[model samples]
Target: TKETKLIDFNQCQQSSIENFIVNGNFPYESLEKFLVCFPKLCSLSINRLVRLNYLTEKDFNPIELKNLKSISFELHSIYFELLKALFKNFFKYIEILTISIYNDNGSNFFDGEQWEDLISTSIPKLRIFDFQHHYSGPMDHFLYACHSGDFRSEF
Candidate 1:
């Protein structure tokens, strides 16, 4: 008797396994292999995986995967640097992104000018931005920067 390996895409489908999970600190190469193997995957969830820190744009290259519409993850103590890197690199085709953060350490990551620059450069295509914070700071500032005309100026 001999063991066998799945090489062809159709063969892997016929093998009768679905919904793969990669846990622990594995290299991005393994993730890439999984994505290549299962291009028809509809949903992928990465939970509490610290190895995700090593993932970058290169790992997402072969991910023109069909039916991949949603990605869900929990990120605690997320630094602005990681957010910048993630947004800059991946999720070009993603329609929805949900992120949950725990505990606010009262750190201001961006100033008015920095926020303006970030909005202009990074998230041009974003239509809906929902903030769950209790008190939002300076709504007018953001609106004025993003929109051309002023409400006061109109009146």
Candidate 2:
């Protein structure tokens, strides 16, 4: 007899999948495989993924996904670099992006100066970008600038 690897709800739960919980670590390898296999995944939530280090655009096989719409996550303090890499890779087809950062640690999750950079560099086709930082103020100024006609002129 031989053992087999099966992907099911029970298998997902038994794995290191942290769903809707604080301070959970998601194995990016399994997650990438899961996403590739599960095409009908509409919404995904991984709260406070402390050890989630990297998510690059190359990891996603776009042809496999058909209905994936939303992804919510709480970023730990040390994963800012990973987030930057992830954003730099993905986010082109993302219609919505929601991020929550740890406030007590004093981390700058998405700065105002970076808005132009993000638009110019990574997410050029991004239609909507929503950010929620526990320590930072709202991105109203950047939103206004992006919405105003002046922003379009640059494009």
The global C-alpha lDDT for each of the candidates, from Candidate 1 onward, is 0.41, 0.48
Model 2 Cα lDDT, one tens digit per residue, 79-101: 45455555554334454566766
| Total clashes in model 2, counting residue pairs 3 or more apart in sequence or in different chains | 0
Task: Summarize candidate 1's per-residue lDDT along 24-140 as a digit string, tens digits.
Answer: 222322344555666665555554222324444332443454355454444433445554444444433444444433233113332335434444575444443332222235664
Report the C-alpha displacement of residue 59, candidate 2, in angstroms. 8.7
Maximum-TM-score candidate: 2
Which candidate's lDDT is highest? 2
TM-score of each: 0.41, 0.51
Once superposed on the true structure, which residue ranges of model 2 sit more than 4 Å away at CA? 1-25, 28-30, 52-67, 104-106, 135-155
Compared with the true structure, model 1 gives a TM-score of 0.41
Candidate 1: give its CA RMSD in angstroms.
11.1
Quote model 2's TM-score.
0.51
